[model samples]
Target: MLITPDISTLSYKRQLAKRFDRASRSYDSYADFQKIVLDRLLAMLPLSQADVVLDLGTGTGQALGILSQQLKPKCNIALDLSPQMLTVARERFSALPNLHCVCADAERLPFQEKSCDLVFSSLAVQWCLSPLDLFNELFRVTKPGGYVVFSTLSQGSMPEISQAWVGLDSQRHVHDYMAQDALLDCIKASGLNLLSSQLSDILMWFDSPEAAIYSLKKVGASLIAGDAHSSVSPTRWKAFLREYEKQRDERGVPLSYQVSFIVAQRPAIV
Candidate 1:
């Protein structure tokens, strides 16, 4: 049976899709950090090659080239929430007849049971409303003995943004990443055998505070925690900048990401 998300979850995903659609054109340009994370995630794959591979949340199809060239999957599926992003991916991989683009929700994968040999996602699972549901779908679709490799932001990500908004406003201005322990628990609960997991801190340097924040939005990742419709006053904006500037150092303004690299697999039948 297909998983059915509640009404609110569906609405939230639509909003996320629209925001990402707007960022589709600019996503590749500002996705340097994403590429870094993707590379690390790909390096954790358990198999050298697979018959079928699914690239979840493949924004602008960055991983398509590497997956197709190196892993050489017979069929490569590039999936995302944004239609525009899928369009870009389709155009980029138009020459590759085996590459297919699908717009779908991660929590409710459209694939049949035990269909994919490799389910890979980079910096994407964190966006789902329920990590358990996301992993359940991953577990369901992955062929027995197949692997699932992914990278997601964990707690302590974007410390600068969280700190800067401390006194300026009561609302949260940054995304609240899930704790590593909770994520691990979800993986276990989903019945996927955990192979290995690692946590690392990645820091990016930007010329200024504006550039640092722009990096998030350009990638369609700047989902704030407060009221979306609330307007920020000039004074508050200035205060936020002032607070953020205090963290600048010799290199430039800093944005931190606490990344969790995970590898899991479905147990093979005896």
Candidate 2:
């Protein structure tokens, strides 16, 4: 359950936090769809009156509202690296007395051992290059037999957007995500008994290609994090649009996403 210092040194996380902070004002605009995915995730949670709970990457405190209404933990820690995100979370959950918001990197959480009875994150760990490191940290913070459940994007999450970039210059504009195989390897290596591992595709239908791309960028979900885009000339924009349209599905622009969900348990103290 030890976190390596290497993850903190990666420059991507800082720039990612900055972009998200700037986009915080507009985050809710594209959040309605994400909420659907989150609702389905919530239906699976094994709820209890836990003494301590940790909500990692609690963006805008959407989950905080539900946690406060349902579990009413003695202490609910909502942690994220983005200051603006924490600001919005704090504002949203102001009425909840037990909740506390802190800015902490996902890969390296700042918590005492066995401090939480449950740990939950939604669509957040995908940002981590070392998902296992974060998973181990989750295990470390949770009490014995506690749950560490999370959901994240899988390899096929953004196929249409990726395919649209095919004709464009290939400079690896987006950050690369680890494959599902690698993710499983990390979880196994963490020494936690995994109760469930499921990956599914949530095919979100958007009105138009521009709308799809714009919404992702508006919520700071753009692929290019901390990377420079090749000069997009006026002509290239036109060509890129044409190439993008070619991959459109029957309704017109196709926006598809695949996701993974996991539920693991910390071994009970013998």
Best candidate, TM-score:
1
Candidate 1 residue lDDT tens string, 1-270: 855667988788888898898889999899989988998887777788889999999989888888888788999999999999999999988997588888999988889999999998999988888899889999999999999999999988988887888977797676778999999999999999999999999999999888887788888886473332245777888788889899999999999899999999999988
TM-score of each: 0.95, 0.91
| Model 1: how far residue 151 lies from native, Å | 0.3
lDDT of 1 at 107: 85
- What does the lDDT come to for candidate 1? 0.88
**Local accuracy of candidate 2 as per-residue lDDT tens digits, 184-258:** 788778877788888876766666666766667767777666423234666765666677677767776766667
Number of the top-ranking candidate, with lDDT as the measure = 1
Q: Give the lDDT of residue 249 in candidate 2.
A: 74
lDDT of 2 at 112: 89
